[model samples]
Target: MRYLRFTNWLTEIDRMSGPISAIWFEEVRRHAGTDAAHVYGGLMATLTAWAELRGVPCEGVPVGTIKRHATGKGNAPKHAMIEAARARGFDPVDDNEADAIALLLWAIETKGGLA
Candidate 1:
């Protein structure tokens, strides 16, 4: 049920955003608990499979890389990431949104928007 909901959400996002040029996700290496790790693995697998089936380029940006890019530190805290996103003119509602914004910026700068 969770996977179904996630895939449905992904489909809605893709529909609203038009043809996806690429897909980028944070590569989380560590988790506080086994359950979290398992969930992350499942989500990652689902996302990669979805992207593969659609022929959309997919890449996982390391957590440290995103933190460093956003806060000049490899292990920046959630608040620091949020500040960084705000500094980029984004009003992220939470750490996850802030990280997403940072990831988008990094992808655009590094891949030239995957052009």
Candidate 2:
């Protein structure tokens, strides 16, 4: 159901603009004991597979890379990351939303797209 909604959302975007040239995600792993990490990892895997099946160009950036891009430190703490987003004039709701915005900016810059 989530995938369906996401695909539908993508379709809507395509209708509004054009085909999305690519998709980007921050690569993450559960490592050992975190439940949210495991769930998000699984969801990302599913989304990646679906995107591949649909022939959408899907790419992932490591968490460290995103951190470095945003804050000059690959091991930035969540509070630091939030601060970095604020520095960019974004009033993020939380670290996760701030990270997503940063990731989106990274994708645009990396893909040579207008931001």
Best by lDDT: 1
Stretches > 4 Å off in candidate 1: 112-115
Query: Residue 40 in candidate 1 has what lDDT?
Result: 88
* RMSD in angstroms between candidate 2 and the native structure over all alpha carbons: 3.6
- Tens digit of per-residue lDDT, candidate 2, span 29-100: 435558676667666777777677778877778899889888999999999989999999999999999899
Displacement of the residue 42 alpha carbon in candidate 1, Å: 1.1
Alpha carbon lDDT of residue 11, candidate 2? Answer: 72
Pairs that collide in candidate 1 are none
TM-score of each: 0.89, 0.74
Which lDDT tens digits does candidate 1 get at residues 53-95? 9998888889998888899999999999999999989999999
* TM-score of candidate 1 to 2 decimals: 0.89
